[model samples]
Target chain A: MESQQATQVVLASRPATARASLENFRVETTPLPVPGAGQVLLRVDTLSLDPYMRGRMNDARSYAKPAGIGEPMPGESVATVLESHSAEFVPGDVVLAQTGWRSHVAMDAAGLKKLDVDGIEASAYLGVLGMPGFTAWSGLEVIGKPKAGETLVVGAATGPVGSLVGQLAKLAGLRAVGIAGGPKKCAYLIDVLGFDAAIDHRSPNFAQELEAACPNGIDVYFENIGGAVWNAVLPLLNQYARVPVCGLMVQQSGTLQHDTSADYLAATMRAVLTRSLQIRGYINYEFTEQYFDSFLREVGTFLREGKIKHLEDVTVGLENAPQALLNMIDGRNFGKVLVQVRSNASASRS
Target chain B: MESQQATQVVLASRPATARASLENFRVETTPLPVPGAGQVLLRVDTLSLDPYMRGRMNDARSYAKPAGIGEPMPGESVATVLESHSAEFVPGDVVLAQTGWRSHVAMDAAGLKKLDVDGIEASAYLGVLGMPGFTAWSGLEVIGKPKAGETLVVGAATGPVGSLVGQLAKLAGLRAVGIAGGPKKCAYLIDVLGFDAAIDHRSPNFAQELEAACPNGIDVYFENIGGAVWNAVLPLLNQYARVPVCGLMVQQSGTLQHDTSADYLAATMRAVLTRSLQIRGYINYEFTEQYFDSFLREVGTFLREGKIKHLEDVTVGLENAPQALLNMIDGRNFGKVLVQVRSNASASRS
Candidate 1:
């Protein structure tokens, strides 16, 4: 299984503006390096593509260092160890690594997380049981603070974080409302994930649809797709509503809307003052040290019990990873977007 | 002394837009009413001219009902009991009441808070130890959550709420930065109030100066001014910063700034996610039931010990209340704006 050449997608150029295109990325082939002392040679199984990668691609002052040009685009993936020099792991063992958009890599054993692929699929660790799932849990429980009978609204409802958020809010006895791009995702939110109401953000009357759905007003709003959805969320937010701003997937296309009218800014500021709204932004790792184990225990159990459901939109090969990411950012993907590097046999999940 | 007639400022008309004017309020003379059973007739001493009055002047959807036309403008004041029909109060007793901008009023005994005016001046109850003080305490302690050595920035630094917030943050061992309107107020913040840094919002180099002052970045931003000040603040906010949204005084003047450029709102939203910033908006009353007693005890002690300082910009008549409020909203008044209805005899405060 150890091929001489390893394939990876590298950032060929930075975007001229917020929007990135296929030309900005290049599929490069490099000779796979052999494992050194305390290192492992791993073949990528599945790679997780998320919105934050957009921020990293640009040279700006951000939470983390920008993804460099001519380097493999930053990402995390589930992989299979082909050869190991560390005592903790052996060949055939699946693990998690920050391998970026790569098909094969040599990584120090210190950075790898051994995956327990007992009853769970390997790719599940790339999303539902990994960073996206942890993000949903931490933001909702720690920031959104979903309470029984409270109404919680999340954007990108079919995506990993939003889907898990809506489901968890429902399990906590909240009125879970979802905002998605199309009729199918909206249907999936209500029928598959048990969302109380689902509104299409792409609809002409999206704002009105959202308002009509949340008659009592929104208590907790999980902000992921910024701009129009945020404008709609502002007025409908209840007094003391908590907004856990997780990601801004739509912002990359310059779709971030703001103060279109004088009243929008005034009303938002006034509401923040009068209604006591709480708008917080965060990354997942902040709560990892404190809440990760509890999250794993709780959400892991829900997944095993079939109480929480997740969807995956897979693209085969490392070359298609860039297009899949662009589609995900454009709200064209139906669910969590993943690049399956190897074969369909490893993609099976209950 | 009981009067045969009373002078009160009433809402003549709601503002056509966000900006309220002198014409919107009218000073009217009417016959004084006798105290009914379980009620007291009170003579207003100091009328608190708060920024919230600007909000009540509008007919828009808000936290409370709009000030009714031809009715006394809503407010809280320190008044002397002139006539009483209840066993709880008698003539000469000073108390706190929701008396509006009136020289005299007939209020139910149940609605009055009997003042324990001893070493503390009665006018201090209208500013430092009253609602403004409570607003400062609750927003800073409950929401801002200031940690020692962290930097705290506040707009309207010379006003009642902001002044107290800065002082409290200082006492808690945090570095305090104040944003005020002019050189005079800026000097007062650093010289009199002990603010580590003071930047005049009116300065040509205001934003640059503010960024330079908070070299470590702002951990807590007490949002009250909401406009150019907010624009200057967004980028300077540190990761995990807590913003207590108490008021938007400058917003009434239509000074509320928004995404003037595409990157403004994008940068703000992105920072909220990456830095894990918390922007919470609230009115003082929400925490009344839970934290009021603590506020009064803590702030009362601070005021008595000379640990907290406050300033007042006073107008001599109830007729002047409208202009004073307008001035406060426009950032023209230097300190906590108050309408001195009667005389300077009751104006003495430590």
Candidate 2:
């Protein structure tokens, strides 16, 4: 194998506030790692940038450990194997790996899943056919349990997770209503994604707008953006409403603004009791073993048949990953944010 | 049959504050109600006074309607059929009825459930074998899902619902930890009811005590009391913990004092997300059709075989119900609060 250079991004410092900046990340050019016994060396093609990375930057308690200072930031990526040491694969095999923000990585063969992309784009595995899509599927199918004609509301509706959640809700015969930051995303949610209604959460009368959209009250609120959006959605939730808490993008900045006058905790608890609400928080991996296969098959078929549509806001080169992630955190990204570590032109085309 | 007068207590006024005083209730002697066609006249044997009735006193939105002014305060009671106009029940049959805070009531036979004593106390139908028992059973079985050896925590440890919840958790092979307002109730929780540990919420180090008690962390929290107790239990909850919100006894007063320094709602939601928590709110009636039979059969057997014990703080007279209910709201009652409207000697022996 050629001794190539790999560009990697690492966490330089923890963010001082709720929002992280590009300064907190450091880019470095390092020698490409070699595959050891039972390992595979891969060149990352597309790196998925997600909101959960914000939590990984903080040195606080969370479901996953914080990214260490000077260490490569954790992430999932679609890659092509440059070399292999196990019977599972050989050179030129396309696979999924947790290769972080690096152009190249040496990963255990057991941790890599070889892709079966016959007529599908390899980059699709990092978005609609991957973790974000699985998160939407499991949280909605298992937790949301959207019944026919029930109003389902989701925030960040133009993003990968929220987009798929709304689509799945619509497929299950639900009245899909979406809440996005601006009119542009809202318009896309209605026109492109085929949601029943879209409310611009940035509007001054967001709560009223949400109420107007969900005339029957929200039966399943896929909670992605917390803070004001959640407050607006709370009062509109109907009896026996299910809230699958997937993300809290608004609160990730750690400087959340809340109503000081009212006891929101008591009010929330009271609402939960009186309305018989189910508020469940989950990470996708919890259901991966049981539901990932079904999710891939169903969502994969939907993608191929044009029943579902996905958009990607791609940033070229591994060095731009920090800015891409920052853009995602600020809701500037119109769709699933991806950092192109290697040009897809060099990889086998579908 | 002799025409006898009956005594009834009615809601005189709505309380302006969190605490309800005697002035809000009035006792009066009225002519006995006669059973119309398809109705049975019942002589109230024991009236069950519960925390939920506190919510009914306020003219607020809830799952059930508020108790009407100048009308009997709504409650569940064990009664004897003094006159039966329908074939479903015969005279002298003891049955469970929503007879409210009245000594005698005329009700539809269809609404009454005839008691099957068979070595069980008829009054037990109003306490351990009735609503409170069913509330504990259904919430734990359906929502809590107490797996063997999981740590279960409950507040209001000596009350009807909390007591039964702890006992049931123990029966389900869980390590039960309880929280109560004082030392005596806490003692009762540990020594009498067989909880693994009991913490006094009144203690200055209540949170610390709870943490010490739940060494393995709380996996299933049977939330009957909300407020300070909930605050302490929140941080101690384990990952993937299930909290079944059956009641909020502490918030019943409607004047809950909470800490202002922290954004508790955001913190709670953050915890919910990071820990993958499941917080579900439900009223017992929701699960009645699905799990009530299993609850009765199992808990009934436990009661008969000395596997479970119950305590009743009985007020012997129809007129004393208001004061008894007030005592219960103040946490002065150590067990299930009940008003004995008629003596056992006057009623047919079961």
Candidate 3:
């Protein structure tokens, strides 16, 4: 595939605000290079488009480095090994790689994790068993420190991390109250995800709805989105409530500027004071060193036993990567969104 | 004293915003009555003027009750028992009570803690040996968990809580950086309080000053004033920073808001995610049931040993109580402001 080239999206410019157009990114066809002595050539199969990517596009200090201008956007992708000079992998083995927004790329063998797609689809590695799942698992288990009778409230409830958070809360004997944008996600949260209560944030009476849903104020609020959703959830948090904040996708849309009035600081501090709340911010990678083993074993077992259900909105081909990512950023993606870079025709039959 | 009525201040109306004025209070000269079956007739000696009273002045729900209309303002006071009908206390005994702003009050013996002055002034019970000091101690020791070699940054550095926080951080072998308004308070923090670094929040380059002071990013930020000071300090916060928010006195002055700009929240969230920052709000009362004994023993000893220094700005009479409290809310009080309602000429001396 070296002569045929690799497809990747690179940052063309920085976004000024929430209304950033797709013109900020450009797709480039580059020559795929041969693997080095300890490297493997990955044929990208599924790419995970996450909300955190919005933070990477801006030239600001965050948990990770911003995607530099003219760099391949950072992401996680499930790939198949097309060629391997490393002893660790075979040519036809399926793997997960950091080769982002691409059809084919060469990377160190150490960077890839070998995958088993037994009963689950290969794309499941990008959703249920991948970064999002681990992010939710680690944040909830470690920082949240949820107890059996405690109530756990999570926003973006239908998304990969949030869906698992609500379900995991229930599995741990905590009341799970899921907050989602629309009725559809709310319905799915109750019927499919088995959340104790689901509130539609789209409703005008969202604050009241959330209060009604959580008669016993929330003990742990898994803060994935921080905007009006946070405003609605803050008052309902119980004393000593633990908020493990992992994502702020809801604030990416410039709504934070509009929503955060002059009293926003005072209001937030008041809530902090009254509730004695613990609002912790975490990135999945920081906890990975300590939590990866437990997460891998427990999540793997849960997936195998059909205890945790995962959903994905898969898009085909490398050409549609930009729009797929855009759709995901706009919250249009129903679950984890992935791109099918190259079809594994035989894997479906196997 | 019973024949001559005692003066009492009552809450006339609730404040909407920064509109809280002395006009919202009314002083009534009511006839003093004898103590009930299990109560004591106490002469108020000192009243604590804390910034948190601003919250109580408003009708909003908080950690404590709002001072109701026509009801004497709720407060913590060191009073001398003039008449006792309860088996727990005798006449002329100095005790602490949660009575409102009154020259004399009829109180239950169960609602009071006996004062142990020892080598400390009885007035210190309303400041360093009381709630303010306990607040700093509990938050720093329990929530901030100041580890040796870590840097602790406290805003409103010269206040009762912040002053003690800086000193306690020092005692724990942690570097203490204090942020206070003006050159004088900054000087007091370094000279009198013995903080490792003291920066004036009033400086034009306050953020830069804080950055230069804390070469190692802040680990424990005792958030007392959450406005511009917080914005300046937020960027300097290191990963795993424990922010034990005590009060937002600066914000209560009806000043600046949190930097809710998308970029700011994005940056804050990124820092939190990357560093695993833990921001927990706390009230000293929560720890009283757990740490009161150790606190009373340790802090009590520190005061006797001259290890902890305390400052107070006393407003002479009961008539000056409103202005004293108002000044405290406005950050004009140099230290703990006490209203001497009655003299303790014949009380047991330390």
lDDT, candidate 3, residue A290?
85
> Weakest 10 consecutive residues, lDDT, candidate 2 chain A?
A252-261
TM-score each candidate. Answer: 0.82, 0.89, 0.75
RMSD of each: 4.9, 3.6, 6.0
DockQ of each: 0.47, 0.63, 0.37
Give one digit per residue, the lDDT tens place, for model 3 in B93-198.
8898987799888888898888987787888888888988999999988889999999999987898888989988898899999988788999999999999999
Put down candidate 2 lDDT per residue, A124-239, tens digits, no spaces.
99888998899999999999998998999998888899999999999889999988877788889989999999988768887888899888999999998888778888898998
The global C-alpha lDDT for each of the candidates, from Candidate 1 onward, is 0.86, 0.88, 0.82
Sorted into a CAPRI-style docking class, model 1 comes out as acceptable
Tens-digit lDDT string for candidate 1 (B1-350)? 34588998889988887677788988899999778889999989988887668878777786589888899999888898988999999888999899998888888999899988876777888888888888999999999999999999998888888899999999999999999877888899999999999998767888899999999999999998886687788888888999999888765555535444444555667878878899899878889999988987888888788888888888898888888888877768876778888655544530
The regions of model 3 sitting more than 4 angstroms off are A1-123, A145-152, A181-186, A196-219, A254-262, A315-332, A339-343, A348-350, B1-123, B201-217, B255-277, B314-332, B339-350
Clash number for each model: 1, 2, 0
DockQ (C-alpha) of model 1?
Answer: 0.47
**TM-score for candidate 2:** 0.89
Better of 2 and 3 by DockQ: 2
Q: Against the correct fold, how does model 3 do in TM-score?
A: 0.75
